[model samples]
Target chain A: MGVRIQMPLSLRERIGMEEMVEVEGDTVGRCLEDLTRKWPELKGELLDPNGRLLLRWTIYLNGRPPSSSEELEQYVSEGDIITLLPLVDGG
Target chain B: MEREIPGGYNGRILRVDLSRERIDQVDLDASLCRRLLGGAGFIAYFLLKELPQGTDPFGPENKLVFASGPLTGIPLGGCARHTVGAKSPLTGGIAKSEAGESWGPQLKRAGFDALIVEGRAHRPVYLWIHDGDAEIRDASSLWGKETRETQEKIREEVGEARASLAMIGPGGENLVRYACIMHGCFDAAGRGGLGAVMGSKNLKAVAVRGDRMPPLKDPQAVKRMAAWLKDHMDLVKAFSDYGTGSPMPRFEQVGNLPVRNFRDGGFPQVERITPQTIKGTIRVGMKGCFACPVQCKKEVEFREPYHVDRIYGGPEYETLAALGSACGIDDLKAISKGSERCNAYSIDTISTGMSIAFAMECFENGLLTLEDTGGLELRFGNAEAMLEMIERIARREGLGALLAEGTVRAAQRIGKGTEAYAMHVKGQELPMHEPRLSKALGLGYMVNPHGADHMDSMIDLFFSAFTAQPTVAVPDLIPLGMEPAPLDDIGPRKVALFKAFQAKRIVADSLVLCHFLPYSFSQVAEITSAVTGWETTPMEQIRVSERILTLCRLFNLREGITDEADRLPERFFYPTQDGPLAHRSLSPDEMERAKRYYYRLLGWDDRGVPTPERLEELGISELEG
Candidate 1:
């Protein structure tokens, strides 16, 4: 089993309109790297030049943010869900 | 007449005294425009100057000002907006709310910067305004009509098929305390019970028609701004594509969405009602206001479970959260139907949904009984009961009569320790944003003059370390010297940032600009200069915004809404039951300290009153006398 990466509708266009994609990785960073490798165009959309998650996006591991000090290095198990959602400003 | 008035102005204010059946034109003062700008600024000035202290909000003495700014009718995107202000029947304080559509621009084009409505009409009446003229016509036939029907009938009667209307529905006619003024069929000045004030006057609607555009000082500059917005549509693609409720799941993840009367933090079912789901299931089209290119306004239609018309528009983020997650109902169709009913009846979705949520919680806790809800199970996740409650609230029937007064008063009337469940600040029901996740916003909820307004201040998450980057910096706050602060910081630095952001927000309201648009302060200053030919700057606009806010504070204080009323609800001071912010809660002491610091930053004394010295600095010291 692999980790399923869920993307918000705002970013689905870059990934051929797929709401969620599955990839194999043990860490959040590796999963995102695999996601970018598959889509190619999502690298700039999801990450900055420093290879960090863009400020506009938040990552949730199974509906909650990872509790580790290093969010990108948080370990994941098989069949875990990684969701990326854009930051909403106002009501 | 054109030469005497400044550019972007008609140099006229329509004054309608319904009591006397008298109509008069008051010349717009150039000085007032220079000092207070317009919209919220004009409302603050007129309400304070004319309204007596302790006047009953629904009494004949209360006044309603519908105002547009210099930027209105200038062919710019996001400029088709207006502010409606009065003494709120809901909060009993300064009431100001803004709406976007064609009505504000039509009002400006009809040869007035603002319309001041006062006194109760002897009978139901609707004002028909055309190019540089006005008439009050009998609206007895239109008294109990819904918003869409009223619009159609008024347009037919006036023989102006294109005339824009601002009208009320049964919710207003019945004087539900949270009734909103519906503009067009979709847009609403949806806070502070301004519609109840309209209802009290026996006024049904105001129909405006005109082709006369206010001459711009630099037409090319205005055109360039419009073109710039058109060219940069990519900047707002998400809004254009999915509209406001597109980020529901994100809001849930961050613990910002109000769940189950703000008692819980997690609503895993939020994905069911997001804009994407709506688009996939029921959305028919996307529309825009006046010259706006973004077209963020959503139009939805469905006939399966409930017949929801597109004319009433679809639910935005606030509506979705208030009616969906807050009530613990994930039935998207029911939520959409509730939204449609609110638009039809002209009640505020936020307050209506929140009131229902409060009642549901109270009922669950045994404070209310089946007998109290008239045999209805007023419980959370009871979508049928929630839908029925919306209708009941609008018509002020049975339990709705208590809820019609809004949660603060309703809890008092219930009197079974239900006050703790009433999540509100002052008398206004809190919007969907959770203050625990964004501490500065919590402080904003406490100290905002009108009470619990999310639009008046910046959300802390936007400025938190998670999202603070040079590329994604908020254009408006950067010019005001704002920097990133921790999301939970309710200290001096956060208060300072809140003060600056509040000033910018007030400027947007004064200009009647749409908050969704990404306009920098300098860009706004440039637009103002282009329209009015004034040598304006960002700092000058900030100062003017401060003046308007101070004036609103004075009006509220004069009406006995003191600094003591500046506080959050009890729910926010405690942690949510679960979610990302399950362990988080706002410290009451820190909030109090932050509020004091904010007062000092705004040059207000410890009592939250603008000091005489500060009033002098703002150039409104004469009002203090």
Candidate 2:
């Protein structure tokens, strides 16, 4: 399945300047794993020491956040679009 | 009290009774100092006890507290910050806004940890402080003057070119509900109508110049700490390079930036107002607060239709979002001019922009006619109209008077479903951040005593990092019995994290530290202990923060800001029209549950009111309204 993954400019600059990429995965986790495999530089930035999805990199699947029950283990469908947003700190 | 107790504090508070034209110095007890710390802590305690319940916010009964913290004036980065607090005329609740500039440190060096002004003066006046001494001078000549001219006049008259002044302008004098107090020319206690409280007291300005250096517990240790922090200068270089503007492009990318009065999730013209564009266009240089190495203040010199004064400083992220994208105006020059006018007139740029955006929406809906807008276009993306509205609001001309009333009250006056379009919480206009993108911030906005303040709690973005990255926040979270929760979850775990960070933010504000400063909880505790010799710990400081927060909540409850009033506008619960959050709106039931969970953690009842046991635990006295 082709899942469209969108990256923020901050991450896009570090990941070969591609605005969006298509990766194969049936679940959100696998999709992210595929993304990191494609752009190895994103591995450290998008995951914790435990190798779990980084919380700060907000992921919107199809223009909406995953429901609480799903979290990162949420299932994905073909043509699903996921946006990776960097952490924005406030004053 | 011992003659000169500790390193961090001056051990005295200057109390000014403007009505009697009397000045008195009161000793700050060590116990109180240890308990409340300073800044927002002191203000909350004082306001809760002294301000009578239901007292008119603009009356003499409402007191204004200008306080500095233990860390202030200690040659530490971000110590230049301080707080101005009062019973807000807009929110009708406790209002504490922190500002960064030279004024707080100067006031600290002038031998006072806090300055409390009460009672209204019979005539216009200004307070002058020089090296622990104080005097009241007639400000009749300085009345109605802009902040820049007032600061200039005060400096010249006081014969101290280095004097730091906090003054108000026509907006304040006219009692604009969201008026701010300008520090020197640019920095401001810009939320909650504090300037109006100053105007109500008939006080025009506060000028201070002090030569006495603050006594530190271990001068060598303080210097060593400063050096250590400065060694990591690269951490803040981006801030130094672009000020708060460094975060704009990132915020835009995240859909956190409020666009087109929050109807849209993204602004296509964001590239025009990014830090790079600002630096390339008119940025002359950068400025810094006292003893700060970051120098995150950008200076812009303008020409032609938007001849912004360099002294008034350049637009930061909030200004850029509020005046630039929020209004759907892509013209950076117009935003710059609007920002300059806001500074010059001593009004809040956030409130002003939000008010204009609300009016523009009304115009779009045909609720407002050309007759109402005085023939101005009053349309979204109309840069000229935006600039014109800023000036008009400052002068209270035509539609300006209604706009100056703020979005909440303005909507009431311009009824016909306009309230539905007014984007505000408890009458104070929302800042640049979008709630749908950051759930925790939205919750903070609803429950914050000051109403819709981003600084009241740690934003969700940081929490997201804490969950995923687990680096900086892990150590801080250890003491609070928390680990990061999932970003989309608003369950008990996330609520706990929110409460912990809220406590930390309270400590930051009370310490008078800048939000931009990267001070870990442990580091803050270490610095406080090193300066005050009080053996402060992170856990103990957090307890104090909890107490401070409870006191503020008590004040709010007493002032009639009930649970019903603690809510986001209808618009926030509606999905955005575009971008990542195109079909996303904060779920009201989930938000309510989050609020309830947070309250429960604080030992408050279901109504969000502090219980008797909670008050006893926090050492807060309940004031019966």
Candidate 3:
């Protein structure tokens, strides 16, 4: 099933101008991988050299932020909304 | 004013009396410096001692103190921070707003640690300081000028291109309750309407130019810290690249960015006005404060619907959310223009936007109409109307006059049960962040003396123990006992953490350091000891913070702010209507408990007043005198 992937204004330049993109996968990680597969230019921005999700972003699955980046492999069902958000420490 | 001092300070305090047109210089005692350090700490000491109980905030008797910390003027990233403090005209309580730019460093180099301004001038004037010399100059020509124009005229009159100015604009001259004291074209001590205080005194601005450098006690250690900061550039590069608005997406995702005057959770047009989009569209360059590596200020230029000037500066995250999402406007160009207008008028963007949002909501509810708006349609998503309202507020024309008084006063003036819709805490409008999404922030809004200030304490989401999901740990906070707790729980652990972090924030503001800078508690303590030679530690720093907070609370209590006043708006009690956080609201009982627990933690009595024993422990028993 397809999940809706949303990007912030800051990421749209690198990931294209679209606010939300649709991708098919079973888990959060798989959907993200599929997202990168379609937009290869965004792979480095989302993941580090070691294939770990960058801590600079808080990947929210259906409006719920993961407790840790390790949970990126959590199951993602159809119609889920995935939002990529930057982590800001201070104003 | 020159005197020999230890490594960190210049050892001078400049005092100005507008009524007498007098200027006095006094040597700052070493004992005082050791006890209070500087910046907000010094402000708290002076305000508690010099100001009597129930002093009018805008009257001639009230005093405004401009202070800088020991680390200010040092060659380090985020070192150029300074603080402007006084009895808040908005909250009628103690208030301090910090600004980072060249002005603080210039003041330090001019041989002054602080400037205390009192009395009211018979005519418009500006205070000028250069080297160790100071004077009161006529500013009749600058009385009604915009902030940028006033800065230009002051610099030209002083004949120093490098001279820095802290000035008010038309908003201050007109006495807008939320007018801000602006520096250069962008940086501002933006809260509590201290600029209106400046207006009440007939003081237009303070300009300083200097070339002297203070001797450091441990230059090598300072250099090492600077090097450490440079090496850790990655910690703040994102801020420099995106300014503060880069995190808009994250805030929106969690329903932190209040849309349509807090009626909605998230904005559908967030992407159009985010930092990335603004950068790609109208951003020309990035700007930095004094000795700062993190250039977290955007320089934007737009020549479309409106001729947005880059000289007025671009919007920060709060500005974006306030003028953009909060108003239901997505046009980046319009938001940029609104930001420039606010800067030109020297009004606080948060209060200005939130005021407009309040008005727009009233309009939607049929409390106001186009006839009431002076023939302008005051509705959500009307970018043109919003832009017009900004200019009108600056000029104080018709409807603008009421709105310029700020949301609290405006709501009172329009009393048809409109107070419920006025989003304020202690008379000051809330910042862009919605407290429902972050409960700790809600607590902060309730307890902050300055009113709804997000920077006063730790935000909930940033807590080390935010959630059970692999939490991101900040090793630096471990010493202060900050760990992740449930994001929404106001449990004892969470309350304890909140109290601890609240102390830390006071320390940061007193030090006058940018909160964005990655300075650990230990690092801050080490740096303080190295710079001031007082042999400080994290524990001592926290103690000093508690003293400052207690003194401020005393000042507020003197202003009649009691337990009944220490509450949030009714809007915060009800569940959010829509967003990722829909149906989430703070428990009134738990909030009351947290407030009581926090008061107890700080050694204050049940009514939130510091006990005599606690005052003795804080070395401020004499304050009761």
Candidate 4:
């Protein structure tokens, strides 16, 4: 079973999905790697060419941030909900 | 004009009589100029000496004062902000607020410290200022356009892209009750619907480009202030790095950021939309406003087509709250889109979003129907629906037209118990903070001369008392730092003291300091002394700040507002689902006690009016005349 990786509110339109983003990976990094592999539209939305998570993006594994020790495969379950949030700001 | 190259000002105030189609210049009294600084201070003097009473807010008699303070046009964390004060069309009272960077400093250096536009224009007109000279030119060509277009048009007309433009949109022209006055294309004087006031005057926009530097009293003083400011480079970095969104987690974690229009502020989606989320998703590069070091204004781009797949202003916390979860929209893209529309249409995001939220709640509760919405579901969380509504509101079309009247009025129209859900305090929608979580902020909203605004005196950040502290989920989450003043210890006296202090600091910040400077009193005091000769003693500074607050109160009072207006929305007064503060509010007894304490401390009568004694204390005894 794979996990679902969703784009944040700000980038959801470009990626074309608000939720249920299916991806294959075993760690947070791999999950993102898989996420970009499928929804290539969001590559620049979340990371630079080097694949570093942009300063404004944060990830949640099953409603909570993944534990430091847990890799993508360590916690990958069929129905895991991985949410991506962006920090778009101005008043 | 009196020229004092260093002490405080550039020595000139620009005045435009739209009815006469003439622009005049005057010198600001130097001694009073230093003490008052800029922005609100200048507005105060203008209101007293020039903008006489009996003048209609919309008629040719009203005055608009835009001034940058002594500390403006400098390279500080708090960049210079221009102030706009005139009799408010929304509340039918005096309204004064700070419009940020791009316009204020340039207007000041162009050889004028203040710009006062008075009288109604004979035709659609925009002001063009080059250096000290300003002219009210025919803007018929500029009519029937949006703010962004107006900016571009003015740029082409003036032949300078560097010029500053503050304009209104169709919403303003139609006189939407909560329209905004947008400057620098992003920032705004978003409350009191000042844009509507501008529209009523048939004023189109004011564009300025100047080539002059400020006259510092002491170059060493300027250098020392700059050096001292450099010492706090870490905070400066943090603020710039995060822009104002850094506070998203703090407010969300603390339960301060209002969600659902102060209805249940704890959005399960908070973590997803935090500043970290913004930084990772759409931020392309760091952007600054004018000469600001802590460039908090972000230019966010939404790629691809959804609702807001274009370039425009990014979403600040207030905008996110206003357009996001407040209306059940969790998508960051939609929030950014909403912010952009507000700027494009020149309307207040807080009010417009709340207006939509108000509509959503009514429809969801079955109080409103599809027929009422003219086929649009008007459902919460519908991004497409929101986009249509924003356009409609700006054009005053269909359901959008109904909502453009504002939440308070719309709720009243939608009957069937919708009033209970209307999230307005004194006809203005609550701006993005759940005051129940923060009593100081609650009190600030209660006492804010302009309806429920967090900008006036957001003491909630420092005191940290009333912020939402989720006890069960995050056990280590304590709302405040080590030593926070408690509600009782911070009785009405201390609360008033804190409120007054924050108001003064706000006056300074609103005029000069960046809203995100986030300094303690000691830091602000140090900066104020180094730049200008005005020394803010611990006690005296706090009191003087309180005095400035009282002046705002007096301005409102003179314009016919009173104690009954000091209020939190009835919704915030009760609990939908209690987490932190519980189902507790200031009981009628407690509220009375707090009000009495505040009144006594300020020497005001129980009615919240400034007593004659209070005016005398502030050396404005003649204001009663």
Candidate 5:
């Protein structure tokens, strides 16, 4: 079973121009790890040096975000959807 | 023979006394240019020097200054910017706003670094400036016209098909306190009621056309920088592709988007009104300002439901949130139509949307009635009512008349508990940003001279997380010694960071650079040096920016806007009903401490007044009123 990861257009060019990709994992962190492993360049964009998700970018499991940082380790299921979005300052 | 001016300057300041129907030109002072640079700096200096204390904002004594910086018209990515300043009718303080397009560059090409207008005109008129001369022409026939027709008629009368113009609409003519001066079709000096000042002068437009470009000291260096920015298009591809509203969903996720008049925590229909949705639906094309490759401006056209003119341009993130989720209206077309109306009528979208939202909240809470709204159901999510209210406000009719006074005054006149719903600071309505999400930004909303402006400081979210081992998304800020901090931190460290970022933003405004561009402070200094042949550095620019800010503060203080007015509305002190920030709230004591700390950091006293020694150190002690 696999989860679908959606990327914003701003980072698409860095990840071979794909808008969404599917990866297999049991956890949100594992899914991101697999996705970043496939596109090594995205590792820096999605994670900080401590391997935590960058605060500037928010990860949503389905339509809502994870409640806290530890929620990254929360279990996922088949057909779960994850989305990445950047929190820019102004217009 | 003309006197020698420095490189990147035409060395002329055009002065016009509309009451006397006189026009004259003064030589730009090189020393003043060195000290203040231009744009916001020049505006601050002139307003502080010439404006008498307690001058009525709409009176003939109020002066309007339009200024361009040393970098203006330099054919760079974000150099086509300028500032307009006057005593604000809304906030009753120093009003300074910036706009970018071809107008500032055109003014530079027309052989003037700045244009100052004073006194009221006896009749309707417009200024026609071309090449190296300017003349006042009759605009009597163009009175009561909307912005598009006004621009077209002025261009035809001036006989310059491609001339750039800055003008106002019926909103200004009727003296709406928040009227904005629209530049070109879409770009606006869109805050602080500068347009009403122009209208008060009975001036309709200032149109300019010229072929001359300012001479740069190092054209090659400027070209190299421009090329470098173009080469780095990937850094701003999202903005280039989708414009500013592309991050609407993300803003909602982080509790940044103002929902349901800033009372609600979330909008389930946020995705329906974003720029991406507009691009897929009503957007016709994308455009950019002079010499800019980012092309963040959006163009939209539609004929169904309601016809939205492409000439008025499209709404950005502020407009989307202000007129959309803030009012609980997710219909993108209605919001687009509302944006068009604002651009056409020369009303400020932020204030106008916010005023309507305030009215909606009042109506929903039983503070206002159907009769009060002239038979319209002024409820949240009522798109038609929102649109109707915009027109009425522009015309100053019915409930629009009250809203046109802005929320603070409207709440006062309503005589109900509606004051709590008026989300404003120092009489100016808040922008679309929610302070509960970013605490430092909330502090900025309090202390900003013009009132609740989003662009006054760097947003806290940018500094909330590091993108790499040692830097945030804005790595340019690293040289300024800014380290990553949490979004909710408003400690001394955060206050210091805020001051540095505020100084940098003020420098950009004074330099008249675009905030959206990711230029480093060193890059900005290098460009300034290359253009003006001055040995500039990042620290020097920061000092100059600080000086400009202090001058603005002095102007505000002289006008009676003291430190007591530096506070957010009570709504911000409480948490939203639901959302990511539902459990979060701003403490008044903490914010008070942060403000005082910020003041002390800027060398100001506890009351937020600049010390005499600090003024002397900045070399502006004599200008103190």
Candidate 6:
């Protein structure tokens, strides 16, 4: 139920992330939480201090946004692609 | 500090009467510029006092005033933004303070504080100003030319290599309600149909080249402030290199953008049409206004050198948003093409794009068909279809005629439940900032005088990204008790203080300083002290800006949009359907609590009119006295 997560271009540059991060969690949110936990320094910039996700950019479960944060809890099948698209500002 | 000057201010207000074929220049009075800070401020005041009410927006009774602030010709931040004010053919208001650096610096260099244009012409004409000499010249040959061509022709005719020109294209000539005036082929006094005002007067362009620069107070101090701004290259680099279009990717990810007429927040192919797209396709150098260090403008040069990439001002965030996601066209090329079309026709790109998007939505809903659209299937993401509509609208041929009138009136004319789909505030198309995500921006838009503009108050952003208190404003009511709250963060007090601070900071841009630079307090103080030698502080400097705001507020009042107009659009109260803000809406009852508190903070009555005491205290519109 664990999958590899890829950091967004913006987040990668900010956190000096590797090509793909190894995360073990049942859901996308869980995976992200695990990723944040492993990359502790990346927490504030990616998630709000209260741990709520910053909505400024997009985080896709596979190729699109997951319906809910809880949707990440769904067991991740192998080869699922999670793309992080964090934009600094929206025009 | 009192230096005796010889002919510093070419203090003459030029008036062109096309119907009478007479041109006159009046002497500049100190009180005029003093009361209205010279640019949009002066124009707004003049329009309120001189132009008669109830006259048709297109009639000769209305006049157009193009002005630059005191810092225009100065070498400070290249902030020479001009103001164009008149009865809006689009919004039917007394003024829309639109500007571009080209018109302003040129006016100041031409040795004039401002240009006041009046009366409609019997035929086409353009104004030619060369170093204090201005005349109404025949523009019959350039009548049908686009903005760039007309400018080239005028420059050629005048035999001047470097001249700042303001011109309208086919859109304005056709009297499109949202027609804008273009300067430097990229910048525009874009909203409220000022170009149409110029067209109605039969004035095609205003070309100016001046030999002198305005005298600044305390040159040494000015230089120091300029140097401080110069050292902060990071801030300047943020805008200049990426241009404002850098936000496209973020907006897509955030779900704050309107993809296909507010139906969706993100575009499927948005990456293919962002600043990165341009970076990958062409070599673009940074561009800027005359005195601006932060050149958020882009100049892309194509190796093949097609007509499109020959080099022009880059489209900013608003243009990208309007022409891209708003219309469901994710192709950067088409968005750039639409921007080029706007420059050619001198129309507001935001309104034009929004109008077309609304039309497309209408088509999808079966309100418009191929027959109605001349056999074009107006579906979302059709770049060619978008191009066809823009060209047609600019030309005022076929369906273009109806769309040229702007989104609000067009929606009303079309009827069929399309009004709800037309995204506008107080009859003006909404600018970029999705208010649900950035509530402060939305509140700013709600209270903006030119109809729901975000620049009026943009603090919601700091709160969203930086501050601890997330959603704080009085939400529309004044003084639950007789006395207002303290100025601290206790309850509604912080909201009141924030509003006043925002108003002051924004209004200083009336002096034409780029808001990006953190130089307002120091340079504004130096300039004030140098000019009048008043011992000024940051707080006092803002009060001077507030004085100008008082006049603008009065103009809005005279234009018949009062405190009642200070409400946001209804759509914002309901949560959005796309993105993270889908379930969130700023409720009216909530807004009422905050706005009422704002009115009380400004010392206004329950109706939100500026109190007589407040007016006297702020020295509102002192010139009329």
Stretches of candidate 4 above 4 Å error?
Answer: A1-91, B1-6, B48-55, B247-250, B307-311, B459-484, B487-490, B509-511, B534-540, B578-586
- lDDT against the true structure, per candidate, is 0.86, 0.82, 0.82, 0.67, 0.86, 0.67
Native contacts matched by each model: 0.10, 0.19, 0.06, 0.11, 0.26, 0.07
- Predicted candidate 3 versus true structure: per-residue lDDT over B1-625, tens digit per residue: 2234667788899999999999999988766665677888899889989998888888998999999988888888878999999888888888889998799999999989999999999999999999998999999989999988899899999999899999999998888888899988899899999888999899999999988877878878988999988866645656766778565665676677889888788576788888878777899998899988888899999787678788887999888889999999998888899999899989999999999999999999988787889988899999999999998888889889999888888889998988988999898888988887667777788888778888876676554232234233344666667765554677766677777777777887787777888777899888887887768888888888888888888788877887777788888877767777687887889889888887898899888989999999988888874
DockQ of each: 0.11, 0.11, 0.08, 0.06, 0.20, 0.08
Question: Which one wins on TM-score?
Answer: 5
Q: Tens digits of per-residue lDDT for model 6 on B64-132?
A: 888766666566674667677788887776556556556777787877777888888788988888787
lDDT of 5: 0.86
Kindly report, for each predicted structure in the order presented, the TM-score of its chain A compared with the true chain A: 0.87, 0.85, 0.86, 0.71, 0.87, 0.73
* Pairs of residues at least 3 apart in sequence or in different chains that clash in candidate 3: A67-B469, A67-B470, A68-B469, A68-B470, B464-B484, B465-B483, B465-B484, B465-B485
Residue B560 of model 2 has an lDDT of 75
Ranking by TM-score: 5, 1, 3, 2, 6, 4
Candidate 1 chain B, poorest ten consecutive residues by summed lDDT = B464-473
| Worst 10-residue lDDT window, candidate 4 chain B | B470-479
Q: Give TM-scores of the second chain, every candidate.
A: 0.98, 0.97, 0.97, 0.90, 0.98, 0.90
Measured against the true structure, the TM-scores of the candidates, in listed sequence, are 0.90, 0.88, 0.89, 0.81, 0.91, 0.82
Residue-level lDDT of model 4, residues B375-466, one tens digit each, is 98888888778778888888899888788888778877777888887887677778776666556666767776767777764443333222
Provide all candidates' interface root-mean-square deviations: 8.3, 9.6, 10.3, 15.7, 6.6, 7.8
Tell me the lDDT of model 4 at B532.
Answer: 58
Cand. 1 TM to true fold: 0.90
Better model by TM-score: candidate 2 vs candidate 6: 2
